[model samples]
Target: MTDPDRPVAIPAVPRPKDRPGRAPAPETTSTYRLGQGPLRLPLWLRAVILACCLVEGLLLAAPLLGLGSARAVSLMLGGFWSPLLGGGTGLYPGQGAVMFLTYGLLHAGLLHLAMNMISLAAVGRELTRMIGAGRMALIYLASQIGAGAVFALMQPQAGPMVGASGAVFGLAAALVGHAAITLRRRRRSMAPLVRAVALILGLNVALTLLMPSIAWEAHLGGALTGLALGLIFAILPRRA
Candidate 1:
């Protein structure tokens, strides 16, 4: 074949601005809202938690005022009264199912009150954000009621031990449940959250085992109840 002269080809387009900039201004999120959604939490939940804690504390101290009748008033009526759970130390219960529930509000000491209030402060606010305040209240009540049921079952002849441990435990479980659901729904792994819960549970268990002063039994009972309630809430259909 005869050789033919041909012009060498050259590139046509110019390389335009491919230099990386400051990450597209970071998606410009709108954070300044006049107000948050209605589900954000009304003052009532906060008020109830604070008011209940305060009143319960006062009731606990009322016995020091030479008012021996305070105990009777608390049990017969309401507000932080330890119900006789029919253990070897106390009298037998003579009321309906509410005794279990009633005992939930009754705390043993300032430490008990502080523990519960701290849990409520941390979990209640966040839960109200996820579910509504009404739902949070329901969860708390259900967890307490469930714990009482379990306690009565476990110790049919146990004493009348009272506290908000069950309900707070429920809240803690709900917090874990919420985190799990949120992570799953967002298509993320739950390993971190699970590890966190596991760590907390381990620490608590160890502390209880080491310190005889702590009510390890009540805490365990409450935690189990709360876990059940949290699982239920997670799977149950939300009302429209």
Candidate 2:
């Protein structure tokens, strides 16, 4: 018998074993869990999507709000017009320089906005994860600048270009470039990357033929810029 004032020593209970015909529950760990959801997107990517949506929303609501044709107003104020590069007066100060990046926020319609936003979300997520948000943003800005430069040089007389397609193409190119570098480093065959390039070019050609109004030049510019940037990033040494 135990003393009344002494602490009782309890017997250790045996651990439960897996029941017959039933699997044991998975052990949860610090790194991951069985039913954990995917990680959320970076802040910058969300901000870009939000900004684009807000711009499009305002344009859509302009008419209902009795503000006249806000779309045209937006294009005039923010669209990338080549003539502006040639000393053309703008509706606002610094419009010529501002249009390069600003045009990405303006979309022609809901469909246009949806497509671009989808592509942006997809590519931006991967890129932000790979190189971080700051570098991704830099690449985006560089791509926009490249697109604007090419458009200004190639389509001097063309109408105002407004869309995020150029930047999207750039991000896609960056992904491709990085993939190509990785494959090369692994001493893998280049056939897959070549096929991807061909596919992209084929799609561009088909789209150009179908929709003559598409800004193919901008896409080209953005792709080239992103590819260069991606190659440089891949070759750079990582900081300790």
RMSD of each: 14.8, 8.7
List, residue by residue over 180-229, the lDDT tens digit for candidate 1: 87788799988899897998689778867886545455566666766666
lDDT of 1 at 204: 74
Per-residue C-alpha lDDT of model 2 across residues 91-199, encoded as one tens digit per residue: 8899888898799999989988998899899888787666667777888889989988898789987658989888888888987888789888999999988998898
Choose the strongest candidate by TM-score. Answer: 2
TM-score per prediction, in order, is: 0.68, 0.82
* Whole-model lDDT values for every prediction: 0.64, 0.84
> Which stretches of candidate 1 lie above 4 Å from their native place?
1-31, 35-44, 60-64, 68-94, 210-217, 236-240
Residue pairs whose backbone atoms clash in candidate 2? none
Model 1 TM-score (2 dp) = 0.68
- Model 1 poorest ten-residue lDDT run: 80-89
State candidate 2's TM-score. 0.82
Give the C-alpha miss distance for residue 134 in model 2, angstroms: 1.9
Question: Which residue pairs in candidate 1 collide?
Answer: 85-160, 87-158, 87-159
